[model samples]
Target: MALTTYSFKDLSGSMSHPTIGSYIFTGEGVGDISISMSTDRSAHDVASDGSIMVSKIAGNNGVVTITAQQTSPIHFWLLDWYNTLWNLPTSEWATTSMLLRNTSTGGSHVITGVSPQKVGDIPYQQQGQRITWALMAADIQHNSK
Candidate 1:
């Protein structure tokens, strides 16, 4: 018999920008991370004649969402990036590159032409809350190695 083990700690990622250098993403203070395609690979249309046609979709876009505790250093790092970009002139604005990897499985997701879709929501309460950041990518490639 064979056994395998996995841990959220094995899941990590990084973001790089011309201005911010690079920021690592670990399990520390992070709640969850997700990557999804903007659209499916294919679409179908049914005709009145009981025939169906499938059209291929050119969907190279994707979104990456990261949830982290407000107390996490990453939370502050992202906030800084957000504010910095906001203050920069449009001519100085640039895209970010991100890489998400699973050490356990040697799987990785690479995102390019990345930009923050919106600022993360802020919350104040007795206990800390998780802030979600959604990033849009013009190109995403997945490698399952």
Candidate 2:
């Protein structure tokens, strides 16, 4: 029998933007990270006559979601980036990029053309809230060692 193990500590990631510089995630302040393609790789259509067709999607667009604790520095960093983008003109807006790697699995992902979907929502309560930030990426390339 073979066994495999995964750990969050083995995952390293960083986010970079021209206007706001960069932030390296250290498994602190961050609760979770999720990556997904914006669209499916293929689409299929079937006709009543038993004819089938498949369309290939050329876009490599994707989305990355980051969840951070309210007290974490990463939360503040992302907030600042969102604010900066909001105050800038469309022509002057800058895109962000991120690199995520899993040391244990020898896997990595490069995400480019990133832009925030919106500011994280804030809620006031007894317990601290976790902020979720959604970023759209024009392309995400996954590599395996």
Candidate 3:
């Protein structure tokens, strides 16, 4: 079994309903895969900004997790989706780097990095209001058997 990373760019959507980002991973056999997300800021900050993380799990197929963080106090939207690739059982897996962009006229969150062992933290000053940002890690694993 082996692991691989895939990425998509400029993804947008609302909270209740989210959109899917696609990627194609070519490999001999599928293994257990875990998915996670990290924005330019910490996951907590992204969540404070009205974003929610949802996992889309699948085996031997493409996986996309939606970040439906709130755009504002009254509205919620998805910034981007990312696949976790470093924690697989295979040590021979490759890392896939992706950069998500804001395609909307308004502000958008972007995700970076592909490590599951790294802790997600807020790296920016709070804008608008000082909301207590909380970080949470969601994991989805798929077994190839």
In the range 60-88, model 2's lDDT, one tens digit per residue, is 79889999998889899989988987887
Best-matching candidate per TM-score: 2
Model 3 C-alpha lDDT per residue in residues 88-115, reported as the tens digit of each score: 4343122332222324333333222222
Best by lDDT: 2
Better of 1 and 3 by TM-score: 1
Stretches off by above 4 angstroms in model 2 are 92-94
Residue 109 of model 2 has an lDDT of 96
Q: State the local distance difference test value for candidate 2.
A: 0.87
Which residue segments of model 1 deviate by more than 4 Å? 91-94
Cα lDDT for residue 81, candidate 1: 90
Report RMSD for candidate 3.
20.7
TM-score of each: 0.91, 0.93, 0.19
TM-score of 3: 0.19
